[model samples]
Target chain A: MNNKYNIFLLATIFTLCIFVLQSVEAESESVYEIRNNQIMEPLVEGLPDPMNGREIVISRIGNCLACHKISSIDESFQGNIGPSLDGVGERYKEGELRLRLVNPYYLNPESLMPSFFQNKNLVRVEKKYSGKTILTARQIEDVISWLLTLK
Target chain B: MKFFLSLLLFSLINSVAGRTENIKGINDNLYDRPYSIGELKSGRNFLQKETLEMELDDFDNPGMIWVERGKELFNSVLEKNNLSCNQCHNTNKNSLIGAPSNFPKLNKDNISLINMEQQINICIVDYMEARPYPLESRELLSLSAYIAYKSKGLPMDIKIDSSNEKFFKRGKELYFERIGQMNLACNQCHNHLEGKYLRAEQISQGHINGYPSYMMRWGVVASVHRRFQFCNEQARAEPLEIGHPDYNALQLYIAWRGSGLLFESPSIRR
Candidate 1:
């Protein structure tokens, strides 16, 4: 009788431990997981490498380098406008960086940075640039990938 | 332990729901009205005409007063510098169109440029060997107003190249970003509520055209930078100092944003 009671108590404790562990994992996964109702889409694949990403950043086509600074290149360029991006990779994970590149204001709604992937239907702009994404999904992914390389 | 855990989870969910509800409330209160570009353009035209007529109504236009003071300062040759503004640019006022508009322009001598206000202060400190007037002081306001008055009606043409792209982008970011205890973005008010009203007065696009305007509220002329500082304060956000590079970038963006609107310096505003 004593042995049976001990076994029963051990089984209950084990089940409870498993439940708690699973809940914690789920909570963490939710942070990185792309939800259906989210304003912006998550990066899936087909992202460009860091070098090409750098090209896109510096180009008027991307314009990320316009306000931010990355120490990888020593081109005679420096802007006092935005924060330096020397070790952004170390500061944030790939998923967080992806979210920021897509729309920095999502995390900090007060961010001056424009939402790169904001749906056009929601955003109002001049007729000429209306209904256009500021950056393509692929470009956004590439930028995120590049940002992750700052470490 | 289980009860405590359940309580923690419940509180977390409640807090998150509360935050979402608050955000929704703010969003609903913000930008409840639509804005039209055509109406904005018309308003700009009306204000410009009214300002031009105002020049005739009062001999004591603040802009004119500043211009007269600037004229005196320009002509007065100091002991250290034998040169006066007359020595370089001559006394022809007509030749000075759009000159002040182009400033905070690049100065060729220092390989670094300064704004009109900075230039005046530099002259006072270095050339005239006089004590530099504090920024926002009557002396500085008068000089900037005088310069802006001279450059009135000239379309603003600030350049943004690779060199300045960073600054431009920063300015753009700042403009759109939300700030303050109210968590209101500039676009939330200026862009979204362009024609709406917080009170009796219409919120006119918050355009920068009539900057350095004579505010009826203040009963004094205020610079664009000063106005920005005021807005920040009103929003309950920390205001950046005048002549700060971030503010300069913001100034550049505001000027560019109000590109279509005609210049109306020293104009009266409520």
Candidate 2:
């Protein structure tokens, strides 16, 4: 019975290691593909939540308000660095918006906007944040969904 | 091969076009100020009314405590060399009045830059034969505060001559180069959006004239380098350690940018 218990424990540990490795691989995997100036695929499985996107835009993780102004948001002291996001929903299609969020540099090399979903090619990132994208794929989708409602 | 050659030619033209656009207002002269005269504003002008009042009233200002400590340190004799800062610097021929505004000056090596804090350390280690104070230490802050206090009301006079031109150029580049997850450059907020609100606080024209100012958040007398580290962290960038060469170079550039602003060390800042 003791020998059987030992085999059972070994099997459980092996299963746990596999689960952890798979999760890490999922995190490192690129979620969206860029085609020219657009990304014609969704980044994650679930439907995007506009409400969650709004919170991220205002919060520090997204910090969109630090440079961009959103008219629908009631927060005071919104920045004016970027153009107002009032009619951004009407301005571009879903794929174009996805490309801009993933990598604004594709359109304008000198654009001051940070690539929220791209981790490579960044310089001087804080150590704790070196390998991390500013936002997760789901978070980027959420932000885009909320931005789409600005019209 | 034809496609490759055409691609290279197109990139060459694009690169040339990009540089001309960026170099619009900048001049070849290192002495040329980024902002024209009369356009510059001291960081003091951005302070809230209550904080401004506190700065104006010496009795109410908490930074005075550090300045007072600095004065004591400046006058105290070192056992190692039987000397004090006041003995050499306060002499009739070498009085340090108006001296604070002239750093980060060229060091004795004449290649690298050294700020008021580093200068103080040099004096202790080289002249007074004493162990140098650690960077951002209370004693070091106090000494710098005392020296800067002597230069109060004098307009800053940073020199960007042949001796320190390279450092000044590096500093200017640093001020404009975007960094971190935020991809923010110093010129974006401080230069373009001065007096604009980020959240609630008004963005000041980034100036070092009021450092080593008393910071309300930390409740301590902070050095300019310490403040730079905080700004880096706020932009989600990695902060270099205190007294890093890059920080000194950035300091030199910022001091030059605000060259005419009056020095106000240990000034109250929130």
Candidate 3:
């Protein structure tokens, strides 16, 4: 009778432990889903080679070269303030890169990079571009296309 | 023992909740009235000279090199065009003195005004038919600092009309907005904590008079917009685009705010 009581108690403890572990895992998974859901929809679309569309990126005239260093091409170019982009294609997936280019600080809240797709209402600006996005939707697409080629 | 443990956990959670509630209340009242231009100036005097040694080797003295580089660029004729800035304007430093302070002026011919840097780029792109250098490029910095250095000692006099009022207001909002995981505002450090330290460096009042100034940390000259870009990044907030309207508005507001402060281009910082 004593042996039987001990076995019952052990089983009850094991069951409780499993239940707690499963609940914690479920909570973490839901949290991750919610975070991903908050990201902008455009970021989920696709990623392309930014180098192939260099003309478009440069013409969008948003000036990514001012801070970034893309060493695989353009021997004359040298900008070290921002990070290097030689292997950015391999480092991040299309969705991750898109989100970063659109709004870098969203991923690393301390990032100094500007948000290209953020609502103008949230960002106060002067009269001319007050309500306007810095880069147009197509321009952002072009830049993203070019960045995807950096691998 | 179980009851005591539960009580401890409950108290810890309650304390955290109370602190969070207090922070939310403070954020809700973020905007009180900003001090007026006159009022703010009275408290902050830009003219009060410090007794610190002014040395050329100091990283803050990028003004000297910028002026030299600007002179070189101004004299050299581009390959596309055999024209130089010296062709139109007198090359003499005395002649060009106080020229840059009156920029971003209205142009009746183009029906659009241009800043000093924009004007330089226009000459380079249109007249010289060359690709304009990037905004924060070393060449741009040297030229801008040289030009601003020529206007050293001139009082800032940026005019604000009804068209620009909205821009000024936006700049003001940005100046005070708290962002980042740290949740710190520009005013929290620049306003209330001036002369204090985050770690080792003492904070300045963020006066903009000496902009297009040299930074020791960067080992190069930088424009006010560049500095603002740096600050935004430091705050862990998204930076505005260079030459973005928001940044331009902030520039205008800063120039206006530091109106009486003597232009101190190439000034040094820690």
Q: Say which candidate scores most in lDDT.
A: 2
RMSD of 1: 19.8
RMSD of 2: 6.1
lDDT of 2: 0.81
Report the lDDT tens digits of candidate 2 across residue range B78-118.
Answer: 76779988888776856899887678888898777888899
State the lDDT of candidate 3 residue by residue for B66-159, as single tens digits: 7789879877887777887777767453356676655554443634445567767887888888778788788877777777777776766666
Using lDDT as the measure, what is the rank order of every candidate, best first? 2, 1, 3
For all candidates in order, the CA lDDT equals 0.60, 0.81, 0.58
Better of 1 and 2 by TM-score: 2
RMSD to the hidden true structure, all candidates: 19.8, 6.1, 18.9
- After superposition, the stretches of candidate 2 with alpha carbons farther than 4 Å from their true spots are A1-38, A71-77, A106-109, B1-32
For each model, chain A TM-score?
0.64, 0.82, 0.60
On the 0 to 100 scale, the lDDT of residue A79 in model 3 is 44
Lowest lDDT block of 10, candidate 2 chain A: A25-34
Winning model by DockQ:
2
Error of 1 at B28 (Å): 24
